[model samples]
Target: MADNEFQSFLTELRRGSLTLAVLGCLQESYYGYGLLQAMREKLIDIEANTLYPLLRRLESQGLLLSQWDTSESRPRKYYEISEKGRLVYKELLAEWRKMQSSIDSICGEGEEDERFN
Candidate 1:
């Protein structure tokens, strides 16, 4: 595959998981930059432009709750997963495990078959 094509495929693969990852991280409240740093620390690479839009969308979807903190010199908005987000995250996590198991089984079978051949 061309490098660009491969990158496109990789982006598509990461897109679906981004929501789940964000929701998981948002279980604890965090501001935009703080969330981005936390995700990077956990090896989940995301850009600020992408994360900011996603946070807004999740809040609009009622999956997240946000509060503005003006205690500091600069005001910052903190986000946390709402109750609905928690339920959705649980369901998504279960589905992700199921899909991962199925993929693993298929790959393992292919490896076993290759050894036999």
Candidate 2:
């Protein structure tokens, strides 16, 4: 594949993980920028515009709670998973495992991908 095509392929991996990362990071309260930084630490190159909308969507789904923190000089909106979100996260994890097992059964276990570790 060409360089651009390969880059696009790698970008595909980012799609499936976004929701998981958002849900996982918000386990503790974090604002948009903090969540972006945390995702970067985990090697996800997510943009703020994309992430903010996603956060809003998740919040709308009753999966998250957000509150504006006015304690600091600059106020920030922090987010955390609600009880429903925790339950949803658990379901996602179970589905993810099942999906991976089904894929492995078809695709074989001998991948060089570090994600398998």
The numbered model that scores best in TM-score is 1
How many clashes (backbone N, Cα, C below 3 Å) per candidate? 0, 0
- Model 1: residues with Cα > 4 Å off, grouped in runs: 109-117
lDDT of 2 by residue, 1-117 (tens): 799999888778666668877898889999999999998898888988889999999999999999999999999999999999999888887888898899898877777366658
Q: Which candidate is the best by lDDT?
A: 1
**TM-score for all models, in order of appearance:** 0.89, 0.81
Candidate 1 total steric clashes: 0
lDDT of 2: 0.88
CA lDDT, every prediction? Answer: 0.95, 0.88
Question: Residue by residue across 8-101, what tens digits does model 1's lDDT show?
Answer: 8988998979999999999999999999999999999898999999999999999999999999999999999999999999999999989888
Model 2 stretches with alpha carbons more than 4 Å out: 1-13, 113-117
